[model samples]
Target: MAKIILNRENLFHNLNLISKQAKGIEKVAIVLKDNAYGHGLLEIAKLASEYGIKKAVVRTHEEALKINNFFEDVLILADVENSTYSHTFHIAVNSLEQIKKLPINTKVHLKIDSGMHRNGINKKQLKEAIIGICEQNLKFTGLFTHYRCADELSTDFYWQRSNFEQIKQEVKSTCEKLSIPTPKFHSANSSALFRVKDFDEDFARVGIATYGYLETDTIFNNPKLKPVMSFWAQKISTREIKKGQRIGYGGSYFAKKDMTVSTYDVGYGDGFLRLNEKHKYITPKGYKILGRVSMDNLSINSQDEEVCIFDDVRQLAKIHDTITYEIITTLNPNIKKEII
Candidate 1:
């Protein structure tokens, strides 16, 4: 079995800590989208529910259909095209057809296309559309938009935040004046979760922030969070190569001098994302990657010609210019992953 490890204990701590910063909040709709960012969908969802996180946000209907029973409520957090599960939990409406297809009694959160310009209803368009939804007689509706640079505390982000606020205020006023149930007012993701100063909101769809790494380098040193996904691998075997010897596929690795290479059962297929050959993967105690990361295995530089490859998810993530999100989430579940 392929060796992969996970740390769930630290994860709970990260969630509780991040929640404290959100001033006024009753529900923490933990973002379970992207298969819980590849941290194992069912497991993390259940864990969240166990830890008191009732609501979860999923990308498509398939993800929602997986563990709807475990969480308190599910929100199709994206504009999923498939209408097969229209009767399922609330969905985020990005277009008119989606809004039109929503169940008569279905509750949905409106996605306002703010300055982000990615996938939301424009401010004016938002106001009109939401009003139309109510007029058309849909179930329940809440308004929410995504923040593009909520993590980057720079001038560019300032503009985005400004526009976001204006839209938020307008939506709030409309919801209040027209009694439209004003969306939960969630314009923040992980980016806005920690760095947006005092973004007091009714609810926050916490995702990567809840998983550990903010997925952004906004804050470092004494940061108020801890990494939750920790991986472990074991050294299967070791060998000594003479000078001028070659290693791995295509003889990409050559020993200028006598060298010892440790082999591991990890490769790009395992979500290694083999970038240039000189990438790294970790061993149980913390041995870095060495040589080419092949489709089925990789080598590590070890001094004693003897090494241990237990598991270390972070080390692998570091190789691909990523955190646990990309690495662990991309990991093939077919491989053996045990939670520690």
Candidate 2:
């Protein structure tokens, strides 16, 4: 079976950098959604807790429940639970309709659409949403927006930030007039955090950057965010092939010269990308993947007992013409993962 090696040192290092950028460890809310971006939910959560991370953000309420003990505050980006409410869990209210459905006394974070338009209520509905929260006796505790182009090279990020700033002022005034407590406001993501010359948000929800990957343009001079997870596969078998011998499905690869090749216990079924002939990928150690990637295995030009498939996903992402998030998050959750 394949395995994942998580570098504890790198994880801590990334967190340290993020903490400083956020101004303090308490202000850095680790985004643990999607099983910690497929680095393993509980695994990353445990490490974050060890490193003094007090807050977390997840996509679902159930995920928050899984790591409730790891952080002081768990913010659910979506979904809601009406049966019970705890101060530990804060649900993001994406729309006015969602605000109406939350249970009484539920801690809610009103997500302002600002500009993303993917989720959250529009600025026009901000006052109405707050009134709905108050009417339902829900606890309004946070005001946040997502930066759609924060990771891209565009002026849209500034526009979005300006929109959020205005939204914050309106929210403050309305909340004060209605005797509603001031909600914690945050909008910067990983890219936005680095883009800001001065870190001043209540807290930043950091994800990819915390996992040792950043997709910003060259202008940011991104920090040294070391990749925390390295995917490895054990050698299932090895063979000496003659020159011109084809390998794997459809015999897509033909040996130019006689060489040793080994099959590794990982493939698309394990959430490893099914790389084809055109997108040649070489391992960090210089082993080349040969032939078509199979569902349960792949052939590599190496004889090592265990091979590091990838330590940094950015290199792999380039081959796939995708982002590092997809490369890492697509990893099989059932694969054995251990902290190094």
TM-score leader: 2
Candidates' lDDT values, in order? Answer: 0.68, 0.91
1-340: candidate 1 lDDT, tens digit per residue: 3554456777778767766766533457788777677677877887777777767788888888887887656788765454545444777777766777664666777787766788867776876777667865775446777777665546666676677778778777777888756666676777666765676766778887776666555453224566655433455678888999888778777778887777766677877567576654456656656667788777777643334443335555666666666765776666665577
For model 2, residues 16-128, the per-residue Cα lDDT tens digits are: 99998888998999999999999999999999999999999999878988999899999998675666756798999888888777778889888989898898899888899
Winning model by lDDT = 2
Quote each prediction's TM-score: 0.84, 0.98
Worst 10 residues of 1 by lDDT: 303-312
